[model samples]
Target: MASGKYLSILALTGLITTASFAQKSDADYGWVLDSSKRSVKNMPQQNEFLNNQYPYPSKPRSMWELGVSGGGSFIFSDIDPKFGFGGGLSLRKSLGHIFSVRGSYNGSINKGADYRLRNTYDGINGPWNGNYLIYGNKYVANYRTKVHQLSVDFIASLNTPSIYRGNPKTNIYLLAGYSILGADVDVDAVGSNGQPYNYTGINFEGKRSDIKSALKDKWDGEYESNGSIRNESRDAIGRSDKNWLIRHGLDLGAGIAFRVTDRVNIGIEQKFTMPFDDNLDAVKIGSANDFISATQFRLNFNIGNSSKNVLPLWWLNPNNYVYNEVNTPKHMKIPTPVLPDADGDGVTDQFDMEPNTPAGAAVDSHGTSRDTDGDGVPDYKDKEPLTARDCFPVDADGVGKCPEPPCCTELREKMMAKPACAITSLPSVQFKTGSLSLSATAKAVLNSVAQQMNANPECKVKLTGYYKGSDKRSMQLGWDRVNTVIKYLVEQQGIGEGRLIFSLSDGGDPNTVDLMGTTEEGPNSIPAPFPNLQKSK
Candidate 1:
């Protein structure tokens, strides 16, 4: 009855605990779902080094396990089959994820009787039947015994990368071991009051209802030997000497375990042990060897050094070691570093780019200054940095030499008319919405603009960027477009930076308009309506 109640509690507890764990969403335990997706590229080189030397690189340390279990034990012998209370304690250590070793001690007490032999002896009037009276009549042939066992087993786990790459909620294992067993046996007989000895009907072969009744009641008789029955002070084989009988045995078992928490687990195991000795019950009449079988429910606890990240060796995958060691070997060395200069401009060796430079000076990224146009004057003193190759000979101010007119008289007149030349608005350059990249058609148009600007060096152009949305992001995007256009003109066309101005329009066609004129009144050199639109840090 007690064993039945224990099974009931175990079933109910497992159901409730499993259901609670099932209710948790994947997001609640992100590590479990993400561990499988980890890649070699993201893992450190040290892990690869460690994996070559160890079975599981991620788990370098593990904890020992201590467990206690209780259940029913039964022995198959000459006597009738019956169950008795049994319990055990064990200590385990893992050698690897799939293999471990354990040492344990288990003890049990049980009773059994042969009704046919007892009935025959009771009916005999005088002579005793040798079959049932191998021992003196003072000791009945029916038996009861207490057994103590010590064993060491090698346990193997089957689950691997599929169900548990690391830690698992459930697992199963098989075990095989050698054991030493000691037994104390006694016999059941009729009492002085003329009643049959301590029979609780527990070992009787009967219907299910009769068995149920037997489990609920205690036996009325006691285990005795010739010495105890005859009221003599002599010692019997197993009754007086606790270590009188000892046997060597082999045990095989299988078990399933469930992790209830990081430090706790619940398991069920069944084992069958076969001993070489035939006198476990103090009777040598049976043809079959004596064997003991136990089915138990165990509660295990992780002892010293328990941590959530630690898992039983059986929960790890040894394949990880081979995979990492072969693929990401650490023999390769890291490369040396190189110097960096973020901006292309010369000068300012630090990583900063100076904006809105004064009139005329050419610089490269290395802080070196020079005049790109070799017009005999330094760029800092030159009025025009991009002096035409055809007009190389220049004055002190570095202005290119103008060609003499065919008619010397028209030279002064043409010079005066040059400043009076009227400048027309350049065709507007359009851009696609949300894009700063230049299209083939846009590039073609900008080529013409570059030519016009080169021809009219005195004239400056205003680049007005516009976008359709009023949000800050949209405004910043417009600002980026304006800057992109300016960068292309300065770098590709060799246009002087001083000749261009940038401005932003909050809401308009999503395009930039380039207006060429000498006047700076309309959007030229005007501050952007929005603050610097660079992204916030």
Candidate 2:
């Protein structure tokens, strides 16, 4: 029995060790990442990693456990006490992290003999030369008994939540339940071969050294009580009637388990069972019933639904939830922020080169105020971006003076010799109502006029401005448009002012027109055709 028990323990140890290694290997490759390889700010939250794809209390399903245990069982009774061997098998199911249930079948076999009665019993006193026949024979009887029990227990976990970290390593629990026991007891006289058993060369000091060899040859040279005498005692205690011998009992147990993996655990347990009868050993002399106790080593293997994600609820620590919740931020519904643009430019502050550019300024793609001619002046402040290089020392408007060329004498002689020619009409330059600013279409028209003037360099062009109103503001606005066109020509196209003439009509066309020709034949100042149309102020 000891050898068999040792082998069973070795087998269970080997299985648990193998499973533990596999569990460790899986954990090494799981979701845990190395902190050295990434910054905390960039790493996923620990709780998020642990609770991935599953929420608390609704985690993946787990398996049940099938277990076997073997160890020593002893009966507390009026008869001489003896050590016995007990073994059991159980099926356990966990309801949650804190509770579970198990059903089990256990059996124990025990043998007991009375050395004092065997030495004193005589034929006159029930076959041992004693005076009291019935009691003496009863005391001398040796008995072998077998007990089978079935029980169901509700178990409560005590330390699972505290022990389970990423992987559970241990669990401790308490259990209590109901049990039913069936027992059979057989007894006979000490000597079956017509001779009293000899105790010579035998050690009766709680040792079984040669006892296995002695009991090997059947019942020869062994102490035994008369079968009839033992049967009478059994019948008195109702053990002979199977229908009256079954017993109900209560059992309480406690155990501690060391987890080998998610799928295996090794445990040690002690359970006490009390039957409601005193005939377990066929001896009814005692006032109290017998107490049966077993202390065993348990090997439990989880079975069915072998998902790695499925762990026993007792193996899950509630601290995991607390850790995740405390460490993770709650998601809030809020509007996205608008990017800052301090200068009100189209470019945001982060990419803007001139974050504080003045309002109404024409800015470039970089948010810097425009400097079209690279003249060191912003378009907002520079009246003439195309100022000539020789005109550097000028006013704040960036207008540069045009120096006269040294060929004045020859140009005067050529002009005096040239004859008059017919002028050609040019397209009108339109303007917005009461405004002097040039539109893109007006600038394009001015470009064409500049090309024509360049082709006919000897010609002087006449520009005539008109407006619907004779008011001073209207007159001033028309004059400003004419001057703006002249400035554009001189600064942008390098056209000389002497080659241009200007006039105004009160209400002729409400637009500026140009004609190019020689001195006398070119368009002179034109009179207004609708004099009455002008606003009189």
lDDT of each: 0.60, 0.60
Per-residue lDDT of model 2, residues 293-389, tens digit only: 7878899988875433345567665455444444563322236778787876555677678889876565544567666445778756877655556
For each of the candidates, give the backbone clash count. 9, 16
List the candidates' TM-scores in order: 0.51, 0.45
- Cα lDDT of model 1 overall? 0.60
Error of 1 at 15 (Å): 7.9
Query: For model 1, how does the per-residue alpha-carbon lDDT over 1-537 read when each residue is reduced to its tens digit?
Result: 434654775586557546533432111122222333234453443365334432322334456789999988877776665568799999988877778999999998866654432332343221123323433342234567788999999998765433213345565778999999877766544454534434433555676556535532433346544211111132244564443456799999887787787678888887888986555554555467778878888999877544323455555554544444355744334467554434333223253244333323333232333454678775567676556678778889888876756677575555434453234445566777667787644654565566556656777778877766657767777777777777778898898778787777766665665545564534324444466665332
